[model samples]
Target chain A: MNTVSTSPYLAGLLQGQPPASPLTWLNELRANAVDRVGALTVPTTRDEDWRFTDISPLTKLSFQPAQGAAQLAPAAIEQWAIPEAAARLVFVDGIYAPGHSFNRAGLTVENLASGVSRHGAAVQAHLGRYADFERNVFTAVNTAFLHDGALILVPRDTALAAPVHLLFIATRKHAASYPRCLIVAESGSAVTVVEDYVALQSEAYFTSAVTELALTGNAEVHHVRVQREGAEAFHFANCAVSLAQASRYHSVSIALGGRISRHNLAALLAAEGAECRLDGLALIGGQQLADSHTLIDHASPRGSSRQLHKCIVDGAARAVFNGNIMVRPGAQRTDSSQSSRNLLLSARARVDTKPQLEIFADDVKCAHGATVGQLDVDEVFYLKSRGLSDTAARNLLTYAFGAEVIERIPVASLRNRLEQTVMERTHAAAPGAEGKP
Target chain B: MIYQDSKTLLSVRDLHASVSGTRILKGMNLTVKSGEVHAIMGPNGSGKSTFAKVLAGHPSYEVSGGEIEFEGRNLLELAAEARARAGVFLGFQYPIEIPGVANSQFLRLAYNTVQAGRGEDELDPLEFDDFVREKMKLLEMNPDFLDRSVNEGFSGGEKKRNEILQMALLEPRLAILDETDSGLDIDALRIVAGGVNQLANKDNAIVLVTHYQRLLNYIVPDYVHVMDAGRIVKTGGKELALELEERGYDWVGAEAKANARVNA
Candidate 1:
């Protein structure tokens, strides 16, 4: 119905798009998403929110939807799985893989493709409600191509003993993927979910992921996402959360890969005395560009939030952080704070950080700050003076910088794994590292 | 160089060094033989600290012309860490605080590193804990300090005591304590001096870089040398320290200027 021509990538995507499921309501959502995306123009640098990131290359590339799940060997797949996790949902190139996943009792994890046939009513009640697809282009794209994802449903008054992990692996070459998930936690329930994005092959690809969560009264949730994709990949992910009265939400996002990766995370405190904690760590090097934008909205009275985002840039890599806290009117006694700390390891490396607090409420307490600096020279020299090698000194300090955020995780085994991963990615110095060490 | 024992531990001959194109040490000469404790005293801006840093292979000091031999090896050829492993310790006047790194871990790494250099067996964490606790008793340090970050939020006196604790652990053969007594109270000064006195023996040498004569009162020096204008102008026994404290450095500077003019 439109006169304007679509980008080549969009044209290719539409041609290979899979047919919607037989459920009429699900089909209606997809049909509405297609028209919504067609009418709204793509975001550009001129937009205030998208000023720092350039998506022209993403629009120019001619990519089609992945044909099928990648058939990676079982041993390679097991090597990446967390053995201690209570349950797991494994997806390969936007399709659920049964052989690679393990589901335990006490929680309902339904695959979206098959979920529509069984729990279609519960799924339809929560899927498209939390994620604002109308204003977000990537969310609109994901909704239009919502073929398969995990549907997590936690019952009332139930507490998951251990974390449920979602392992989303990419193996499609030069293809675009849309991965979606919706989690609904009932009253007085508690759960923790971890999503890990990794690629089996080192080929160019596009991955746009969206996750929605709705926590009812007195529910608690912990969400952790780790992105370790390949060097030639482009990754964009958004997590939208809604917290009810007296509920708690805590989330941490760690970005260590992808040539160009962008993460947008936002939480809405909709009821009285709801609390949330948002923290993240980003480690990018070697011509990589990683950007993270976060928002914490306090809509009700006496809501509290804390946010901390840290970045370490090296080897001509660039990092950007934009954190906004909005304390709306009538949200009295709202306590919100945000801090962004960045360490640049090379002169060629760059970082731009902005922490904003927009308080319309009269009796709210809020604070925010951003700091960009290199490692301390005198500290490095002091380490070297104690018989540590130059590289060892730098590695120690760099690890300590990122460990501040990793230490906030409560799981010991998961923390140990992240520590090792951070060590491997942070061992090398950026060019000279330039200090006396 | 004159000494009762024949073996020399450190020999600096006509050392000239600069930092950032500004000359700091000009043709400095000193010699310390084994079984000796030497104290280098000077007024401010006499390059006493610079000489200590240069001897420890600090990267800031560019050696325009110098030759330093420690334990019969050319100290200039070794890197800073190599010099540390080679048993040359420089106790900093101002210790830097490294946040987020535990003090116990830093001490373990440092101890194991130097031990490995000497082909000695390295201690694991459990073994090193017992060893470090025994060493801490020598300085009267609490065991709870092991849990805190390295020098973070520590008082000035506590930092000085930590420097002494490192000296006890490393057991360096030639230690140049640069102004180790600058920021210490009387009680802290006593403990630090007592630890240094116990560590000194006939097999090694100690060089104390200080401004006041109070430190020499506790740890008596075999030789006290006066440095003026980046060069040693007077050398005598421990009695010189008392004389310098009593009559002040102006007399020495005047005498040195007169001698220099006569020689020229």
Candidate 2:
């Protein structure tokens, strides 16, 4: 168990002490990752993925090591908790809130800090294995100060009846929330995890988070990320997943808020006959900006990956979508597809899309496509003629655009919650609530 | 009021329109007053549908030389949505399928847009649901149809009924039923025609554009105009539709070619 403290350095030292000689390599890796975070500059308008989205808001924040010491008002975390989750982990200002958590059998949900302090071997072995810190600065930073995340471990052949919910709340006082998560499903295990990051208040803050997931052979895993930060909040999150032979992985990311936000996800099909699906939907309004970049690597033969990402941009908001699929050599019969679509609701709204495919294997079926467009007038007319007002019609069309991704989500309740979030965000972006449900 | 019973709902004089540099409606002329139902009967490619689309301000159709007035206001000046707001509705021959737009939500937006254009407050979802439920009843449409996406996965009959449901809700001053019967089965035609009849008040006019006189049997028009070679060659009463159906379109075409030769 971790001793709660306000000093970030003391908290870091108490949390970072390695257990024994056997775990020295991982501790060293964590130190190196921290150095990388310090060396590498946070992305700005200069980077391709960060072009349309400005990180100036993030750079202005004086990020502190949030040591899970801040107290949240009664019933605050409950308002954002997933009601049907079998197990729930709540984090307030990047620190675990033990009193707000729900317990479950055959499942262990602990803060990364405590996991490192207690279950050091298990925590250190798989903490940063899946995530590639070299490719992303935020991931490196998360690894360096990876003390505030939730670790979920599902033992072999355990099929959880309900999803595990992880809630991270970024409050105005905390100013910054750095969240790191690790979910490992052993062979033949089945589990669903919903990771939600929300702003507790409408104030300027930053959330830098990382989630690393692994699926052993034949394990089925479902993961969903719902980011509903405040209008003045800056959010950066990355998820890296590794799939073993015959394992199935389904992941969906919904980014609908924040002033400046970025989501980077990478899925590696490491063994033969693995299945990976990455789906995302984003709704942006006001002067908000959101950037999403994804990569699906077919590292072995007989692997399949499908990626679909959709964005709705309204007001003067901006969005950027980058999807890439890599088919390495000898990865035969690798069926992979990637598509990114953007619908601009306002004339001032803008979207930049890039879909690329690199296929080194000749026997692979790989395709990538990207499209950016305004709502089709004819399509709008079709709806308006049915007696919907212009604003209502546009909102319906926008919801429908994002629904394609929401429908693919395995959990119905989470999907419904996300639908409401998307509708609310869209209404805020649009002129009126004429068509909102 | 969105309509005046004694005034002309639609008036076109020497109207010309083209798409992609190809002329479609060449000097077409027509007029319809509120409370009147007029059917424009013509063969394919005779510009019957173009007249309807141009009146609705389809983006691709260029109104090169035309004067269109609806209830004394210049129709050609309004954009498609403005025209819609100004009480002009066009039932597309091929209704586009908008994948994500719900059938119910689309109807509400259209109704509210028209209301807002007429200087009225917009209806919220709760109010619009009641409004649409009442209209759907007249069309004999199931309540579930409102939850589906616009025109997506709809059968031919369902699409036609959906169009009529829209016409009933918006209550346009002049409803251009462009090939509304093109892809309907007998059951769909009856339901669609029934819906039109329920909404057809004495204050609004209807313009039915079709190639066949089949739909005329369900909803008889007050007048019928025979168009050929981009121009109307003849106009008569409802009996004209029966006559054209019995005699075929050769007589109208022959007369049109004769007029073209004389003009040339």
Name the best candidate (by lDDT): 1
- What tens-digit string does per-residue lDDT give for candidate 1 at B1-264? 235665888999999989889998888999988878999999998889999988887877899997999989999999888888899998999988766567898898888888887888889989999999999998889898887878888888889888889989998989999999998899999999999998898877899999999999999999999998888889999999999999989999999999989999
- Candidate 1 lDDT over A304-404, as tens digits, reads 99998999999989898999899999999999888899999888999989888888999999988889998786677777777777777777788778877
Worst 10 residues of 1 chain A by lDDT: A428-437
Per-model clash counts, in order, read 0, 15
* Best DockQ among the predictions, by candidate number: 2
Cα lDDT, model 1, residue A400: 73
* Candidate 2: Cα lDDT at B183: 83
Model 2 per-residue lDDT at B54: 86
Task: Evaluate model 1 with DockQ and give the value.
Answer: 0.29
Model 2: residue A221 alpha-carbon error in angstroms: 3.2
